[model samples]
Target: MFRKASRLRLDGSPRRVVLACCCALFVAASVVSAQQPPAQRITTNFKDADITQIAEAVSMATGRTFIIDPRVRAQVTMLSSTPMTPDAFYEAFLSILQVHGFIAVPSGDVIKIVPDANARTMPGTDLPDRPPSAADEIVTQVIAIKNVSAAQLVPVLRPLIPQYGHLAAHPASNVLIISDRAANVNRIARIIRRIDQAGDSDVEVVTLQNASAVEVVRIINSLYQQQQAAEGGGANPLRLAADERSNSVLVSGDPEQRLRIKTLIAHLDTPLESGGDTQVRYLRYADAEKVAALLKEQVTGIAQAAAPGGGQQAAPPQQQIDRNTTIIADPETNALVITAPPKVMKSLMSIVDKLDIRRMQVLIEAIIVEVQADKTAELGVNWAAWSEDDDTRFPAGGFISPVGGSSLVNLAQLAADPEAAAEAGIGIPNGTTLGIGRIAGTGVNFAAMLRALRGDANTNVLATPSAVTMDNQEAELKVAQEVPFITGQFTNTGAGGTLNPFQTIQREEVGTILKVTPQGGSWRT
Candidate 1:
């Protein structure tokens, strides 16, 4: 039983009845106390009452101590249809404080109510097992992060916590100190366990066969620094170390990163050849001369940029050109003739691989046909036509008609108006050049469409020519025979004043010829 004779409050303040039910509960407290189960059941129906009055009543029933700070003042309204056990009632009380931006922190033997922002500074229950706290009850947890450095997780996890929540990392111990609501702390802990795994990260020792371990490490670090600066990133996670004692390099990072390091090491650690050798590198896509010039410029720039040891000046541009490198392009074979040591050759070949990519090409296919439009050549279809004589040719499958004559449809003009053409059961998209069923052309705003109407369509294929051309380039196809014609007035005579039988004549080539400048930019979609 609680001491009701003392009209003093739980915090030494005078109590006031906030509602009629408040006094009734205090009056019937003796009866309700007798009915309290092992887990004290609470039947609460709080109105717009001071939260302090509610806390005082809880202390009277449960015998647990509670200290409400002077700054804590708010009105609460809660109603429970049925009774709640001690644990449930406790959670409910904590929630009321949390709704007012306060937290219930268990300090020493008594629970202290304070602002959530100051909960971390006050004494609280330490839960290491990370059991989720009840309601919004603030708790402290020291979580030990494994596999990864705990400090690394702080920056990633800080944004997830609230402003009043506290989160810190101990680098030496690789542990995280989190002071927030119990549920939130436990949530952050689960996230840490998921990402803290040391997945496929290890150290590999690469023995140097020819190259210096220190020099290899220096090149790798230099490239990494350049990339990092370009991307504006944090410190590199990879650790590269040179072991002079064993002439080996130690790489520590993810397995994929280590594989890349090993590949670079393999290329750099090759035995130097005895002397210079010649090799022909055929250019497949890029021009040999252009590639050779680019190589000369790059190699010379590297030499001139390189500083000599002991603070000596670098070699001049002209002198750097002959630094054990000789490159020439053979126009006949479109190949590069290189003369250099094995190490230099290997480096040059790698550059060639990146530069010699096949450019986009367009395949232009064409068919030249003379579809016999007349009946005699139409492969059987004859069209009626009016003519004065009986020998006149018929174009389609119709006999002569006495009534006027049928005019052929102007296909090119009809195609220009898509709306009108659709009424005729045949129409293409507006601004379309050509379409054969589903096959269509993607114009680069330069191609023109040429279409004509034919009857029965007897097709006599004259020639089919196709050519491959580079982007934005042109190609020509011609199938013709040379014909000789008289050019100069000369009699048929021999060398000795006798007329030559073949008389001076000029030979001219005339037949089917096609030229197309394909602009293949539209295919990218």
Candidate 2:
């Protein structure tokens, strides 16, 4: 949690101010930007120091790179207020530090830190001396063409169309509308026709602003629905909604879609909730007070909804169904995304940021069940063996061994009986081995599904092991135990020897949860 610093205050005069005055002449540039700028650009103050040096120190801490141009410094000075307190000085100092490249994270009284941007580079390495080159993106094509045409897009659209070109320059990765105007709809249609035939890969002219950042996202999510509609493509209206954070939602006409939306919300990196098919919502929160309030409400709501009378219709207008569905929250943004019945979405959105992991686990488990029931699992082994070079004749091994012929031994034996194997210098195979386990009796095909839901890449855990006990009234080892569902093994009316319970291996294998302890030993779940 970040808190105000006590040792500093915002008063115009402080001990540092008097000392700063004596040194002002030596660093006129450093103090200048601290005044004459917009209020948003206003800064506290620095006791006496070079912003460049401060930026460098901050850059070293966080992994991001920031540039503190002289112009930016001037802007800061121009916006600063008269006089300064240690606190004000610190805030200004930190702000500048951030602009230069470090994230000025506040932790209690201390301003915890890190690089504001994420850049991949070795520690202690300096940021490049030049500005970064722009990447080759689709938007660049439009910008290039616009540059060649001195007539601004504004001029082209102002007189003829509803003109919405101002939205084209949003910095974020989202859609922006560009109104089309060439006198009439026919002229616009003709332009589209020409572009379609000319094959201009990047600059597309569409009938509507369909491919803008936000719209593209909506179209991508509706890919499946759109495909289905396209098969029978007609005049059906395509509706799209986004949960908060601008994530698109699947449009559903009723309750089932509501549930799915809820489920997906629980899975997002940011918490998403189920809202009615009509509305998509995203909730953003930055302040600590708001964060606290949101969390408290979420927990209370979840608990109440889980209660018996929680969803009672007779309850007051605010009463909601007690469905303790889980919500997932984004750590960085403190935003919650949820898809719920419109009612639920509206009522529960306030607490979206308060979701926890337990609900997430339950939702995931449900998905696992659905996912596993539809897939197949397989297992195999990679093994090592001896080659022809390892073959040898033993003249008197059974009291007679090969006197002059080359002897052979496995690598394992050579390691254990080094003296003897080394003397023979026998060849050995070194490789891995794999094998699949068979279901003890039923032989049901479920391996693929089992693997999909349970496989752990790191430890080679691939499936849940289950066992069922069988009743043996006759108490005969040869006969299959008298199990409730399976046929008697001993009564095998088929060809093989009567199924003998004692001869068969029991399905006793079980998965053990692997946990690393502080003492370095492992324990099972």
Candidate 3:
């Protein structure tokens, strides 16, 4: 029996041993390949190629050209302009292609840009003429303008028109929606003057004393057509009208068709002048940040309404994406409005809708602590104020007193006497010290404990003296990156006993409460 056991342990069967080794090798290869990043191939000749490959190829072959097909007829319409750089030009061109159903490929020294390769060409079809101007340049300029605000617009305008910033927040509060064809330039100018005189009134009404609805409609129709021509019919006037109606009120009823007149009450940032005349316009601001923040709040509100718990987290938990997109008063001025990319906007909406309720406060506190952590002096409006817009346990613009309570005490009020608040432990403002209870026995899980540690109470809880399980392993303490504050490796000795096997433990700042694990895990608080 001993001799048989020794032979089995040695695995004397060569074929069986070879098969097992081959299986292990196969699994190892699969695991390694699975861990590798997805590959992309980019081809200059073909309409469809991998993006990653193209980026890589471009980087590799700086100035080279390779012809994909010589048989295809080259009745070319060359529209070219030298921009800041080849890369910038390519980016701008790519943006245009994304909007349009077309793609461009750079082959060696030459680029083989094409429409859908699968499309069948129609006989006697008149191809539309490409716009004369550099589309990329126009788009870049428009995006830059869209990203700024009226007040921020000062510096940019100051160089052109002095004393721009000093002109007050709202020089003209009224809005004017004009038609592109209507020769009512002077009329709109007068309305602007009146609005400018209103001087920061809550409701700076712009009175359109002249220009009938028909004329405005005609101008809008023309503007719509021009936009359609530029964008290949992606711009819809009806959609714009719908958005306007959704945001504000409808003004007119069509004489023949019974359609309502569109009211453009929203402020405009840039002065829209086409054909050397003032066209359809709105009273807008460059502050896209303010608008973006408001939109995010609205999104959050909508999410909270859908949530049964009356909090950010959805009932069925969903993944949260960091949506950095915002429509703020343009940083440069309140004269123009810009928006983050559509994806950014969509992500922001997703956050408002799908924020984890359990992690809602966690997310908020994390942002607050993270922002203030750097002690950066250039902190803008309190982000908490924006988040407060949602009907949460916390009051809007006030100190959140244990979740749900009215009477908002702004940060200014809290900072008035931080020491007293810290000492009393009740209604202590942000940055005030508060005591945290370190309870023993099986009361709260490690997750709950960590949450409390990072809570407003600001207490550190040590779990070395207590029992903790790591994946059904009877361990005194389990530490991993998933558990915040633990900044080291997790080693299991399989001893199953209370072992003091701490390799290294690093301390954090005074406010930090680092958690040191028995298996070489320590939190840098």
lDDT per model vs. reference? 0.67, 0.33, 0.30
Backbone clashes (count) for model 3: 62
Give all TM-scores, in the order shown: 0.42, 0.15, 0.13
TM-score-wise, the better of 1 and 3 is 1
- Per-residue lDDT over 1-525 for candidate 1, one digit per residue giving the tens place of the 0 to 100 score: 222222333333344444545645643562375257666566776766667666766665566678777777777777777877655666787888888888888877778877777887886767646556444767778887666656667889999888778888775566788888887887887898788776667889999866667778988999886544433221225679998657799998767678888998999888654444467889889899989999888777756565465556555433433467889999889999987655466567778888897767888898888876653211111122223334543222232221111111223335467567667665433221331111113311111232223335477888888998887678988778899998767556567896654457899998988889887665752
If the candidates were sorted by their TM-score against the true structure, best first, what order would they fall in?
A: 1, 2, 3
Question: Which candidate achieves the best lDDT against the true structure?
Answer: 1
TM-score, prediction 3:
0.13
Give the 10-residue window scoring lowest on summed lDDT in candidate 2.
Answer: 360-369
State the lDDT at 192 in candidate 1: 82
User: Candidate 2 lDDT, tens digit per residue, 1-525?
Assistant: 222222222227776566546335433433343333423222233344444434432332222344332233312232345644333444445555445454343333333334433211112212223211321100111221211111223244335432221213222221112322112333432443343221111221112111122433354456546443432221122234544343334343223434443444334323223222323234442433454456456656655665555455555323333342334454556554443434354456444445321111110110111133343233322222222223432211121222122112133345458788778775332222212322222223111111111232223334443322222111111212233333234433445665535234344323233222122123221
Which regions in candidate 2 have their CA more than 4 angstroms from the true location? Answer: 1-295, 298-322, 337-341, 350-525
